[model samples]
Target chain A: MIPVDIPLWADLLASLLMITGGALTLIGSLGLLRLPDLFARIHGPTLNNSLGLGSVLLASILIASIQADRLVFQEVLITLFVVATAPVTAMLLMRAGMYRRRADGGKKKAPQPDEST
Target chain B: MTTLLPFAVSFALIAFALAMIFAGIRLLRGPAAEDRVLALDTLYVNSMITALTLGIQFGDRLYFDIALLIALFGFVGSAAMAKFLLRGEVIEP
Candidate 1:
């Protein structure tokens, strides 16, 4: 067994980061359950993608590097991908919901006529 | 260090999995298509986090790659679902 030792400070920080991130994710999930509408639910996952994932990735990078005595930058790539993709997906979902509501004749305020429309 | 890490990671992962299950239930129970879509989105995010936790547990770099791929594919699937909902069609051609 290769004896791997991480400094106490590093361990404490990493654990704190991971636990906080996990808690945030749990809260976001609870939001999904508690929110009353589709739009409201969308906000929950957005929080996870932005802050929850960000914190977790940071913790992973920090912990791995300290334990292995080498820098691990791969987590950065994942973080970048998640952040870039989340907003586009959310926007698409919102637009889709709006379109479907309109089609179903649900009670929604009418969009003002625009040259594009 | 080893013991503490394994316990922490496992606890966190379990919590996250429970959350995902709740979100899944919401998806199934949604009265509206858009509500289901939002629930599905939450499911994807939770699964991604679970994958990350697994990577930490096994100390393997490849798991990170898998998580990234999942994120990519998840984004595409979500986009397609949204598009289908929006236009009543997925493709124009």
Candidate 2:
């Protein structure tokens, strides 16, 4: 027993937002494939975390609130948490990568250990 | 509202799920540890979104709480992994 009578405007808006979120996520995945290096690939997932997740969360909130006939803010909390954490993780990972590269003597000017000691 | 809800939730879930799978691919194919870490972060984000969609679909407020917890844990795990990568140890003596 659910109402099948939704205004056309609501339906249109929800569908549009959902599609936008999906398209952004798909594009991010494609970017992940197209990017050249680890640093560059990180950018793609950032897009997914920010824009992709944001849109979907917004759409969920809108649809749920409209259907339930009451204000729901749960999705808001999730969105905030995701946005807050994604960048920190990305930054830490990048730093780690840099450190590992340096330790492995991948740097062009890294001095070699003395051969005759 | 129900009709529209299903379509919207399903579309969002499918898209985010696909993104997670794609990220998983990158994780498996990563040329370096950092790349894998990046993919893992993306996976966590998508999982949170998936949980939110489930909440909306099923009309359960509790799932949102689960999503929040997952987000928190994912953040801590990613931070630890990054720290390990940077210092070669997660804890210092």
Candidate 3:
């Protein structure tokens, strides 16, 4: 009963992509909640950063392009930004976490000077 | 397919809401400073996704700009916080 102007194929593809992307994002957040410890939880967001967001952006691109009858690819900018920045953020956070752990007297002892030499 | 799109979009929206809630819970309950920062990072990303989905739902180009802004600032915020955590200052002297 809904009045959709886009072609059925495009609608099907966009819906499929959106649904899949949403599911992946949900799973990523669930991982963030269920995983124990900061180190383990850090792995969770990466899931959404790559696969989940990528698919959703693809769906956005598809829907926009089909509706406008031209390739409206503005969403690609987001994909590019996320791809470029995700690893950097992950690395920075990991390094910071390590720094904090060390500052708090981490599990392993620091190496001592070679006194036997 | 016409009917399917609405259902699919709604599902996506609901999923995003749930995801945001989970991220918020993590942001609030995370024990360490780094954990809170990570949660904040996730929160922004989730918000960006919500904006993108809203764009899709409403067929608006404006939300794309919103999503882009969120992505840009989220990265900057997360990176600054991480740097502060590591060096005790966002900018080194």
Candidate 4:
């Protein structure tokens, strides 16, 4: 067994955070598989990118800081980059989906005919 | 408490691996290009988590940099794919 020198309190806190984050990520991926449509499936990764990733990043930061005996926050850079970019990705994907659907001649119900037509 | 961390790290790694599998399935089974791109996005995110968990296990800071790079490239790839799907070209003239 390899030696782990982390103090008891930090160990407990990090463990709990890791478990929670893991569970959330698992649930999100499950949703991605089980959801019925594209729009619904998009929600799954959204959950993943937000809280799931957030908690895991938090745990990583916590452990690194404790080990270094100082404020080691490089992990925070990943968090910030993810937070800034995830929404943009989602929005682009959503719009692209909508555009493709419209290009396919719209949904089951035809677009209402223009009154002028 | 020391014993608890090993268990937790193992659990997180397993969960992250499962998530990656799920995302892979979605990517393959996608009924649309957008769905595939989204699945790819999720795959990278899961991989990042997996890298982080491994860092915890090995007590190395190097995995943190790996995760950051994955996040950067993954976003660029997914965004480009999505834009291509929307406009039929990744870069509009």
TM-score of chain A of each: 0.83, 0.81, 0.81, 0.82
Global lDDT scores for all candidate models: 0.77, 0.74, 0.86, 0.86
**All candidates: TM-score:** 0.88, 0.82, 0.90, 0.91
For A1-117, candidate 2 gives per-residue lDDT tens digits of 113565677667767777777778877876777898766677887777887778777766776777788886677777777767778888887666655665443434323334354
Query: DockQ values for all predictions?
Result: 0.56, 0.54, 0.69, 0.75
TM-score of chain B of each: 0.89, 0.92, 0.95, 0.95
Q: Give the Å error, residue A109, model 1.
A: 4.1
Candidate 1 stretches greater than 4 Å from native: A1-4, A103-117, B1-4
How would you order the candidates by TM-score, starting with the best? 4, 3, 1, 2
Task: Compose the digit string of candidate 2's lDDT tens values, residues B10-71.
Answer: 77778877888888898899888888877787788778777866776676767778888988
Tens digits of per-residue lDDT for model 3, A1-117: 223787788788888988998898899898888998777788998888988898889888988887788899988899899999989988888877766665334554322323364
Clashing pairs in 4: none
* Residue pairs of candidate 2 with colliding backbone atoms: none
Encode model 1's per-residue lDDT on B41-78: one tens digit a residue.
78888898888877777777677888888898888888
List clashing residue pairs in candidate 3: none
TM-score for candidate 1, residues paired by index: 0.88
For model 3, the stretches where C-alpha displacement exceeds 4 angstroms are A1-3, A103-117
Per-residue lDDT tens digits for candidate 3, residues B1-93, read: 235788888999999899989999988987898889998999899899989989988888899999999999999999999898988999887
